[model samples]
Target: MRRAEYHCAAHHPRDWVEDTGAEVAFSGRSNVGKSSAVNAITGRKGLARTSKTPGRTQQIIFFNLDETRRLVDLPGYGYAKVPVQLQQHWEKTVRRYLEERVSLRALILPVDCRREPTVLDWQLLKWCAASQLPVHVLLTKSDKLGHGKSLQALRQTRESLATMPLVSVQLFSATRNVGVTEARERIVDLLSGQGNGRKPA
Candidate 1:
């Protein structure tokens, strides 16, 4: 498996890296433990920068696993104190990247296991489905709940998205290291061109 290292950061469409090689994007609502999960996956403590305040990271940070594979830390949505127009711009930026980036192979979505998918999360799912893109979801922060609750969350998430042929869900906990190995294996496969375990729906 490729060990990810800090690569580059892009805040606007014009600044994005060259559109070559494969990329897998990580995204979620603010404070979804996304930064933590990303850190755990890459074995880099400060690589993704865990935020004390949600939605403060305003740019897409890229981490390279190799010359041809990257992990994209997309700016968190849904809880920043920024102006409405800025939020809209961020949304547009993320959507445009997702839609137009030819090398983007998969998405790694982190949703708080304690709650249902946020509106932005749903919008992303719908958009990826329409784009025939593959997605893998992490029911993040599962350690906050009991094992039964965690399993239930995973099951419910799977059930809710069962109709989506290229989507898969798994429980994750950055704090306790739960599901870390599984997530890494899956990600390695995705970055290796195996993709999300199926063809588009």
Candidate 2:
């Protein structure tokens, strides 16, 4: 695939691009390395800007690999110091996009490997489950943990989601280039309507 290029950013659904063609979305808590993972998987440094400050990404940013394929970066949730009203707006916007976007193929959820999935993470998972949307969880920042702890975390996350067949989890470290290939392949699978093990609703 060609390198993804910046397409657009939308703060409201009315600003969203035409909802046609396939796109996968990446979402996670603030400071979870979501941008880093996007850059690693696309092999394009700085494609998605990384920021030390939480709530830096305040809009829905789009990166297109081609006319028909794209990747979306959603505003980070949880732990952002943004105002409550703004957070509520983002929550509604993201939920609407996830539930209604026709071209969205799947969701890529990144969480910090050093910590268990947070309450907001579970809420997103539940939303995906309700829609039967395919979700792949990336245990980001895996390099911070020892090999054993990383594996244990992965196993525990898998076990926690054992009842949710549409959700898959894996350890990833964008800084170390670990699991980048697998994540890319999974994105490809999802875009082509293959991965996820079930048809989207």
Candidate 3:
């Protein structure tokens, strides 16, 4: 995780660097803490810009994970306040990147634990499933719930993902430093060519 460093931000296909190495993408609805999780995973305080402002991440940012692998922070979706044209552009950019990137190894999806996955979340999951890509879902904001409630949320998420064999679910709280180590290990293993699609135990 120490080796993770900012690489570049790409707003368009022409601006994107050549996709030639293993990479994983962090994706979620606006304000779901993708930036916070990225910062927590890499132990970089200001790496991804934790912001209360929704839609702060307006482009796909790349970060190098060690020497040969990379991490991607994709723009969030499903927020309504943004202009229609801008939202359409985001949708197109994200879909194109996911469908065409050759070196993408996995997806890290974050969702609020207290609420059921929104329609947009389900849409994203379906896209990943269609692409035959593996995923790890972080039930963010788990610390805001009681232990029993958090466990229930995790269980619900896991059950919902039972049909998506290549996707795994886990309770995570960037605020409480929970599940960071496990998340790092899973990602590092994926980068190491372990494409077996192991489920969380």
Candidate 4:
């Protein structure tokens, strides 16, 4: 474990932690292994709750790395079973956070390895590009595929988003602890403002 602890949960901007220092956020669709990736990266099992059910994470949850650094878990998107009004609220809230939070360093986007990126995923990537926010894509559940398939998925993702200079893609499998070290290093670089993507305007 990397000494991570729950910091806070925010339902709105007023509920967000003080915008200072640097923090990296995890965003993904429901049931996409976002929580698994967080736990793997931190070396702390169960640090973020994992569930088979969709729409479990309803608020923006924050985990503290230290007083000056943090990890944010944004609400899962693209769950149709969730009420439409609530979904709309989440969309508005997430967009505001992405655009306005100064402490937000980068976004970690987890996509299922078996399929192409969802439309909502592309929307987020484009949004990050417009804001110059660096994004790291984790092809989660990669252990389900053979080595060749995993590599192919990674290459395809990279090729599809080649025009987006700030977006990077890598194969990841929380069950096998794949790419955890690389993910951690990339996060550190982003927090230290060393990533290629520029800060949002």
> Whose TM-score is greatest here?
4
Q: How do the residues 1-201 of candidate 2 rate in per-residue lDDT, one tens digit apiece? A: 446898999999999988888899999899899898999999998899899998888999999999888899999999657999999999999989988898998899999989988999999899889888899999998999999999999999999999998998899999999899999999899998896633433
Comparing 2 with 3 on lDDT, the higher-scoring candidate is 2
**Quick one: ranking by TM-score, best first?**
4, 2, 3, 1
User: How do the predictions measure up, each by TM-score?
Assistant: 0.93, 0.96, 0.95, 0.96
lDDT of 3 by residue, 1-201 (tens): 876889899999888867777888999999999999999988887888778989989999999876668889999998889999999999999999999888888899999999999998998898888877888899999999999999999998999989997788888889999889888888887666575442221
Looking at model 4, report the run of 10 residues with the lowest lDDT sum. 192-201
Alpha carbon lDDT of each predicted model? 0.84, 0.90, 0.87, 0.91
RMSD of each: 2.3, 1.5, 2.9, 1.5
Compared with the true structure, the alpha-carbon lDDT of candidate 3 equals 0.87
Question: How accurate locally is residue 50 in candidate 4, as Cα lDDT from 0 to 100?
Answer: 86
| Number of the candidate with higher TM-score, 1 or 2 | 2
Clashing pairs in 4: none
Model 4: per-residue Cα lDDT over 1-201, one tens digit each: 298888888898899999998899999999999888989999989799989999999999999998788899999999999999999999999989998889999999999999999999999999899888899999999999999999999999999999999998888999998999999999888887887844432
Per-residue error (Å), model 3, residue 170: 0.7
Assess candidate 3 and give its TM-score to the true structure: 0.95
Model 4 earns a TM-score of 0.96
Best by lDDT: 4
